[model samples]
Target: MNSFCNVKSVMRSMFSGFIAATVILISTYAIAETTMEKVKRTGVMTAGNSGSYPPFSVMEGKTLLGFDVDLANELGRRMGIKVKFEVIDFKGIIASLKAKRVDTLITAMTKTPGRAKQILFSVPYYDAGLGALTAKGSGILKPEDLTGKIVGVQLGSSGERYVRSTLGKKVKQVKTYDAILLAVQDLKIGRVAAVVNPIPVLRYNSKGAQLVTTPVWKRRAVGINTRKEDADLMAWIDKHLSAMKNEGFLERLDKKWFEG
Candidate 1:
């Protein structure tokens, strides 16, 4: 009778332990869906951007346009789903992604060593670097010429870091704007001496501003940003970009947008 009781108690304890372990695994699995799986399940992927950078992503009378817009759409197409873009602030993009507010980032986000610590990137899709735009004929001949002048960059962007890292103490003041367009606008109105950002952005919005030609700082490869845990989705994006490069599809896109 004593032996039987001990055996029964051991069996019950083992069963309870197994149940606890099973519960934990289930809980983890419930919240562990890959970005790709979630996209497929919902029939859409949300691409986040500021919609403030032109010729890459911009808001034109409620319609989003530019290279990144088409890129997100293509990504969705390849996955056999639809893509929806959320106009989030540039500074909040990464936080939103980590919090699961976005499936991927299509903003002109560059692949930097610092950013790589928080997010994964697809292969480089464009050759990109930083440039400065100032009021026409401002005599800011080179990047170094910005010394003693106020330079503006979008807050929480590589441009901000570029000035601090490359031109630290050379410039009198570093102004930060919520949008790179605002930096450009400030440069136009003499609020800031210059706006530093992607070369494409500076070039496209240089209508009333002058683009600096002497120095292209912070040259980098730009790619889609995904959550670090979404290995499957990142792989898919890298593969898609690779195919686009090999098939000349990316060339056509560059020609249509950049060459235009």
Candidate 2:
């Protein structure tokens, strides 16, 4: 009877140990399987963008075309996965990425300290600076000229940050727009004295939009953004971006989208 009781106790202990080990193993695997593995397993990677920013991302009829679009396709090709884009509003794009509605953000999103806390930014893929656009002959030659004038800027953009932080009390009123293009429209109609946005965007639109792009402000680096937990995906993107830079792919993109 004593031998039988010892045998039963040993069996119970073994079963409990096995259950605990299995639970730990499962938990470990769950932590190890991240977005990188998901992308590889599903054979698809979805990129998020505002879809309104031209030269970077824009909609032509029903099709999306821009530098960011091409870059996303290139990334997918390199990764041997199909790529798709989710056109989220500019203000909501980051939230969409955080919610895992998209695998990455392919918008020309700048890296800011504030944004760094919420998401991971890959190695910079592009560089740009803030530009102030005014109607021709508006007499706004420098930053000081914007004092006491109503200014328009895209909501949640680096341009908005500059206006709020640098031009704070100097400007009369700040008007936020969903799309920078709309702010340009307001500028054309005299709704705002000036529109602050990315230099590349302002330069592209100034050609025949009856607008002038002032000297660019401080430079900002634009990078691919992913959820904080998707560090592996972010690193993977950085590696490919390095390869693209080395092979002059980025230069080609610059020529196609930015250069004259």
Candidate 3:
């Protein structure tokens, strides 16, 4: 009877030890699975953006600067990770996301139904719309006036779509150098009649081009782009955006870039 009791006590002790070990292991894995932990483990979060988009993103010398750059840096800081910006064409942004070349896309990408099919978008951090930029002396002012004239636009952009849908096939199309800077150097030199792009981008990039913008479309919400299956990262981004909205960061950024 004494031996049996000792054996039973030993068995109970071993079972309790096993359960405690399992609990600790599970907790450790849960901590490791956190988004913040994952980012830290990777050391840096790769972000995609159209580097030519001024105010939102632009290459100042060799360093990328602008609202999107600052926003991505802030997000990385909050996540306790470093950020590396990968400048990519606008049309290839989503493809890069799928290829895992970048962890997220911080470009001024509009949240459209077609895009939503392939990727998940965070809560909108900015509102933008299609607009036309013409030289100060150019007669073009509205969408209708663009008929039969060469209009420069970034390929695969909403501005391109809007122009195609609104102006039909008769309108002359001039592709810009990239997906962000619709106003190519030639456009300012009379190579193209006018450039169409998101209003905020046009206004931001038009420093001394003697440009005038005509607001021709409603505002579209802009959000961060992530892979569809990255629910953890998506939730983290949504929370961050919500907090920024609540704290007026979004408004502050808009004022700095758009209102100023």
Candidate 4:
């Protein structure tokens, strides 16, 4: 009888432990379901972009459209979500992502070593080099011509970094606007002798402006940005961009925006 009693007690304790384990598993699964369900239920993925940047993002009257916008829409379609564009300043894009104001940032942002620490970047979707645009017939022909000249750049951009690093203390730096177009405008008015920006952006925004470009530096990759810990979303975006590159979708978009 004593042996039977001991056996029964052990059985009861084992059953209780099994029940607790089951409860924990169920709770974990419930939490995961809740997190993933929000994305599908909402049906819209909010994307942050600097709409003032041409070729990558811009406002065509009331409609927001450009390479980044199209790419965001394509990503949403692949993810089975509708896309909602939120135009934000370039300088504040990372802040907005951290604050959860947008799901992702698909602006023409370079994948730099410093930014990699703060945000998760999807696989590179494009490659661009740093370049300077000067008024046509202006004496500034090469990177060296920028010496001792006032150069305008978008605040907090790689363009500014390139100029500072390359020109050292000779070039006067001006942070006029978040958009490269404004800097180009300043260049036209002789406020700044040259405007430094991504080669594609400067070309896209230069319409009727007497602008000529000289390559200053190279950026190895450009990528979409998402908040840290968004691993699933980042993985999905990486796969999607990879497919776009493989299927020639990216090339088509590039030609339409950059070559055309």
| lDDT of candidate 3 over 77-187, digit per residue (tens) | 776778889998887888988887888899888876778899988999887787888888677777888888888888777777777778876677655556455455657
Q: Model 2: per-residue lDDT, tens digit, 23-120?
A: 99999987787888978889998889998888898899999999999998998899789889989999989999988899899999998889999999
lDDT of 3 at 172: 70
- Candidate 3 regions exceeding 4 Å error are 1-37, 137-139, 179-184
lDDT of 4 by residue, 103-190 (tens): 8888878987778999988888888877888888887867778877888999878888777777878776555567788898888888
What TM-score against the true fold does each predicted structure earn?
0.83, 0.86, 0.79, 0.81
Per-residue lDDT for 107 in model 4? Answer: 86
Candidate 3 or 1, higher TM-score: 1
Itemize residue pairs with steric clashes in candidate 2: none
lDDT value for model 1 = 0.83
Candidate models: Cα lDDT each: 0.83, 0.89, 0.79, 0.82
Find the 10 residues in a row with the least total lDDT in model 4. Answer: 30-39
Q: State the local distance difference test value for candidate 3.
A: 0.79
User: In model 4, how large is the Cα lDDT of residue 41?
Assistant: 75
The root-mean-square deviation over C-alpha atoms between each candidate and the true structure, in angstroms, is 5.1, 4.7, 7.4, 7.0
Badly placed stretches (over 4 Å) of model 1 are: 1-29, 208-212
Candidate 1 residue-wise lDDT, 1-260, digit = tens: 99999999999999999999999998897688777887778898888998987788888999999899888788678768888999998988999999999999989898778899999988989878777777667887577888999999989888888889888998999999887777877777788888887777677677533445436766878899989999888887888779878888878888887767
| Displacement of the residue 125 alpha carbon in candidate 3, Å | 0.9
